[model samples]
Target: AMTVFAEKYGVKYLAAVKCLHKDADALLAFYDFPAEHREHLRTSNPVGSVFATLRHRTARTKGALSQKTARLMVFTLVQAASKTWRRLQGANQL
Candidate 1:
């Protein structure tokens, strides 16, 4: 279901799906899940552990991306380029 929704929206679902695995040692290591608990956690239920961690991390990362900054930069560049083009056209006319 999630994979279908992600596909429809062109979003990456690998992280979310991968979190469902009971033995995600590699991922837990990569994310720096505590060394002592890593082994025990491998067999533990991940519903409220890895799944929650992945969801929270992904949300934080996504939320931190500056969409407003990107839009402002694009708008500024386009406006400047259009003004320059119009000036060039006016000069050519004269």
Candidate 2:
């Protein structure tokens, strides 16, 4: 089916699947996560969305000038992001 689709359309998407096939074991290795946690790990976008704001902050700095500055900056950013984070749908089960 994938071969037929590749022939009909562009091979680009199929090529990506082929690349993933190389790590098929890794890709499929998530089954051990608790069912409730499965949804969260399916994509990094939830945590990543918070970090998107962090990216902007860090992008503005060349690097943390000092360890203390970096630690405080990250702590502050995480606190702010935490307030806006939605509770995961099934988190209570855990």
| Candidate number of the best lDDT | 2
List model 1 lDDT by residue over 1-94, tens digit each.
5346446644455565555444456544644654544444455553454345445654766755477864665455455544533222233323
Residue pairs in candidate 2 whose N, alpha carbon or C atoms collide under 3 angstroms: none
The C-alpha local distance difference test score for the whole of candidate 2 amounts to 0.74
User: For model 2, what is the alpha-carbon lDDT of residue 73?
Assistant: 88
lDDT of each: 0.50, 0.74
TM-score of each: 0.23, 0.51
Write one digit per residue (lDDT tens) for candidate 2, span 40-77: 77755766787788789988996755889878888899
